[model samples]
Target: MERWARELTARLPALAPDRYAVARPPAALAHRAGHAWEQLVLPAQAAARGARAILCPANLAPLASRRTVVVLHDVAPLREPGWYSDLYVRWQRAVLPRIAARARLVVTPSAFSRDEVVELLGVPADRVAVVPGGVDERFTPAAAAGPARAALGLTERPYVLTVASRTARKNLGVLDLAARRLAARGVDLVAAGGDRPQFRTEADTAGILTLGHVDDALLPGLYAGAAAFVLPSLYEGFGLTALEALAAGVPVVAGARGALPEVCGDAAQLVDPTDPEAVAAALERALDDPAPWRAAGPSQAAPLTWDATARAMDALLAEIVA
Candidate 1:
C-alpha cells in the first residue's frame, strides 16, 4: 500500500500537478494509532488542503467523508474470515461497508476483486473500477541470476521459486507436498517471504528452503534465477508477484484461482492449487521447456505500468471532482 501511494503520488505531478496533492497524517499520529490515525486525522488534513475529494489508496477510508475515493484491494476478510484474527475481522466488517457505502468511487486492483467487492460487500458494480498494479522496470531478464542464487545459498542447483507471506491462504501446503514429489526429480523448492512458525516447521519435512524476507534489491535477481516461478495462492487481489516473475522473463506456474490467471494470462502454466500433483506436473513442465514461457512473459507484463494506473486514477479523480 505504501509503495502504491508513493509511486502514484510521484507520477501525479507529471499527469496534473495543479489538480492533485498527496495528503498524509502527522508522523506522531501515524506512529501512535496506525489505522486509527488514517481514520481520525487524514480526512481533516485532506479537507484543509482544499481538496474536493480525498483518495485513500489503502483499503480503509475515513467513515466521516462522503466525497472520498477508496482503493479496496479485496474483500478477503469477508470471503475467508477464518484467515484473520477476530478483532481484525470485526474491524473490517464494521468499517468496509461504511467506506463502500460512502465513497464516491471505489478502485480495485483487478476485475476479480471488483466482482468480489460487488458480490461480497454489496457495493454497486458501476462504483468500482479495476486498476491493476504494475511491475517495476527493475525486474528484468537482464538482472544477474548468479548472485541471488548464491545469496540464498541455492548454489548452482535449479529450483522452483514462490514468493509469498507464509500463510494458509497462500496454499503453501500444496507447495510443500509438490516439493516432496519434486525432490525425487532433483529439483528444490525455494520460498521467499516472511516466516510463520507453523508453516516454517512444515517446510523442513519437504526439504523446502525458506528465505525469510528477501531484500528488495535481490528480488529481481531471485526471480530471474529460478527455473520457474510459482504462485499456488488460493486467493489474491492482483497476484503482483506473478506479474513480477513475468516481467523478469521467468517461466511461471501458478494456480488458476483468483486474479493469477488474469495476471499471468497465457504466459504461465496454470494448475489446480488444491492438488499437489497438478502443481508438481506444471513445475516439471515449466522447468523442462522454459523457452516458450520465457519468450512470452515479458510481453504479458509489458502493458501493466504504474504510469497507466496513475493516469486512470487521475481521470477517475477528475471525473469525481467535476
Candidate 2:
C-alpha cells in the first residue's frame, strides 16, 4: 500500500498537493474505533469530500462505506484457521465475504486468489481483476551492496536471503533446517524482518546472520547482492519479495505453493516448503548457477504500476457515480 500511495501521488500530484499527508485522529477516537482507518474522522472525511467510492486495499473494509471496491489479497485465514488469531480468523470468515458482496469490483493479486474469491464468495469471475505487483525503482542489479552490507555488518559469504514478517504460516521452521544444511555446505543465511526476533534466536545463529529491522532503503541492495533469495512460505497470495528479487536479477528459490510459482514462473527453483531438504537443495541449485536463471525472471512487470491501478479504480468509481 505504501508503494501504491507513493506511486499514485508521484504520477498525479493534484490528488495530493503536499505529496504526503499523515493525519492522526485523537487517541480517544482511535481507541473507540477498533480499527483506526475506519474511524469517524476518516469516514467523515471521505463522505464530506463527495468521494463516491472507497477503495480498501486489503480484504477487510469499513462497514460504514456505502460504495466500496476492495482488494482481497488472499483467503488464507479462511483456509488455514489455526494460522491466525481467533479474532482475526473470525473476522475474516464473517466480514470478508460481506465486503466482497458489497464491493462493486473485487481486485486480487493473482489468478489463484481470484479463483478462491470466486469459489468462496460466489462473486463473478469478471468482477475480480488480477493486478500483479512490480519491483520498485529502488530495486536493481546495480544497487550498491557495499553501503547496505557495511551498515548491516554483513561478512561476505555465499549467503541465501529470506525476507518475511515471520508469521507462523510463513514456515520459518523450514528455513531453520535449510540454514543448518547450508552452513554444513559452507554457505551462510541472512534473514530480515520487523517481528522475527524469536526466529533469529531459535534458528541457532551459529553461521546465520539476522539483521533485525534492516533499513527499508537497503532492501534492494540486499536482494541484488545475495547469492540466492529463497522464500519457504507455505502460502502466499502473491510473493512480492520473490518477484522483487527476480526483477533485481537475483536467482530465486521458492516453494511451489500458492501464488509463488505463478509470480516466479520459470525464473525460480521451486520446492515444497514443508520439506527442508528440498528447500536446501533448491538453494544450492540457485547458488550453483545463478546466471543461467536470471533471464527467467519476469520479462517485465508491465501494467502493474500504481497509476495503472488507480486509473482503473477511477474508471470503476466513475461508473458507479454516474
Candidate 3:
C-alpha cells in the first residue's frame, strides 16, 4: 500500500500538479494509531484543506467522506476468514460495507478483485475499476546476481526462490514439501518474506533457507539469481511478486488459484498449490531447461509499468472530480 501510494503520488504531480496534491497525516499520529488516524483525522484534514475529493490509496477509507475514492485491494476477510482474527474480520466486515457505500469510486488491483468486491461486498460493479499492479523498473534482467548470492552466503548451486509472507494462505507448507523433494535432486529453496507466528516452527526445517524480510533494494538480484521463482499461494489480490520475477528474467511457477493466472498469463507455469508433487515438477522443469521461459519473461513483463497504472488512476480521479 505504501509503495502504491508513493509511486502514484510521485507521478500525479507530473500529470496534474495544479489539480492534485499528496496529503499526509500529521506526525503526531503514531504508526500504531493508523486506523484511528485514517477514520477520524484524515477526513478532517482534507476538509480543512478544502479538497474537492480525497483519494485513499489503502483499503481503509473515511466513511464520512462521500467524495472519497477508496482502493479496496481485496475482500480477504470475507473470503478467507480463517487467515485473520475474529475481531479483525468483524471490524472489516462492519466498516468496509459502509466505506464502499459512501465512496464515489472503488479501485482494485485486478479484475478478479473487482469482481470479488462486487460479489462479496455487494458494491455496484459500475463503481469499481481495475488498475492492475506494476513492477518496478529496477527489477530488470540486467541485475547482477553474483553480489546478491554472495551477500546471502549462497553457493553457486542452483536454487528455486519464492517471495511471500509466511502465512497459511501463502501455502509455504506445500513449498516446503516441494523443497524437500527438490533437495534430493541437488536443487535448494530460498523463501524470502516476513516471518509469521503460525509459520515459525515450519521455518526451522532443513533444505529450505528462509531469509526473513529481505531488503527491497536486493530483491531484483535475488530474483535474477534464482533458477526459478515460485508462488504457491492459495490466494492473491494481484501476485505482484510474480511480475517482478518475470521482469527480472526469471521463469515463474505460480499457483493456478486467485489472480495469479490472470497476472502471469502464459509467462508462468501454473500448478495446483495444494499439490506438492505438481509444484516440484514445475520447479524441476524450469531448472532443467529455462531457455523458453527465460525468453518469454521480460516480454511478458514489459507492459506492466507504474507510469501506466498511475495514468489510469489519474484519469479515474479526473473523471470523478470533474
Best model number under TM-score: 3
Measured by TM-score, how close is model 2 to the native structure?
A: 0.85
For each candidate, C-alpha RMSD in Å? 2.5, 3.8, 2.0
Model 3 lDDT per residue over 1-322, tens place: 7678888888888888898878777767754487788888888889998888899887888887898998888888788888876777788889889999999999999989999999988898999999987987889888988888888888888888999887777878887677787888888899888855423233344667888888878899999888899999888888889999999999999999888999999989998999988998898888888988998899888888998888899899888788
Query: Candidate order by lDDT, highest to lowest?
Result: 3, 1, 2
lDDT tens string, model 1, 1-322?
Answer: 6667877878976789899777766667653286777877777787788789988887888898888999998888889887766777788899899899999999999999999999988998999999988887888899888888778778777888899887767878787677876788788889898854323222332567889899888999999888899999889998989999999999998989999889999999999999988988888888789999999999999999888889888998998899
State candidate 1's TM-score. Answer: 0.93
Model with the higher TM-score, candidate 1 or 3: 3
The per-residue C-alpha lDDT of model 3 at residue 4 equals 82
For 221-284, candidate 2 gives per-residue lDDT tens digits of 8988888888888888888888778877788888899999888877788898989788878887
Report, for every candidate in turn, its global Cα lDDT versus the true structure.
Answer: 0.85, 0.72, 0.85
What residue pairs clash in candidate 2, if any at all?
Answer: none
Count: clashes, candidate 1: 0
lDDT of 1: 0.85
The reply for model 2, stretches above 4 Å from the true place, is: 1-39, 196-207, 298-322
Clashing pairs in 1: none
